[model samples]
Target: MRPGIHPASRPVVFRDRAAGTLFLIPSTATASKTIEWEDGNTYPLIDVEISSASHPFSTGTARVVDAAGRIERFERRYGRRPAPSRG
Candidate 1:
């Protein structure tokens, strides 16, 4: 319970440019622009390039790397090392 130690957090509108989505959340970030939300209130407007709505992992559009296949291919190309003999 210190006084003025933490940054002030307020409701700010974060707009995802790629997905064209808007989110109203409390943030310590600042913005020069302003916007009127659906609730008929004006809040700070923060434009973002991407968000969970447009991210590949969230949208299930990300490619899953085949590690095993890659290892097999690498072994096939550059032969596997022989087992070391115990002294």
Candidate 2:
């Protein structure tokens, strides 16, 4: 820990674009910008454009990818034949 050069730690609100929601938590950040909340208090609201809420995995939006087929194709073009399965 240093003396006076450390980043300021404060409470912040992170807004999720996908859910259109605000999450309040402690964070080192800047000051509030505008008064828009019900309490008339505004903190430096950090807006995150993307998160797991809208991402492919956590939101049941993942797509099936045939990566193994591509690997087989590459092997057909350049790689040697792998040893046959014994089990």
Best by lDDT: 1
What is the Cα-based lDDT of residue 75 in candidate 1? 94
Candidate 1 error regions (>4 Å): 71-87
Q: How accurate is candidate 1 locally (lDDT)?
A: 0.97
Global lDDT of each candidate: 0.97, 0.76
lDDT of 1 by residue, 1-31 (tens): 7998999999999999999999999999999
Model 1 earns a TM-score of 0.76
- Which TM-score value belongs to model 2? 0.56
Worst 10 residues of 1 by lDDT: 78-87
**Which digits, one per residue and each the tens of the lDDT, describe model 2 over residues 1-87?**
988998878768777788787777788877545325656777677788876667778789798889999888989899878799999
Clashing pairs in 1: none
Residue 26 lDDT, candidate 2, scale 0-100: 85
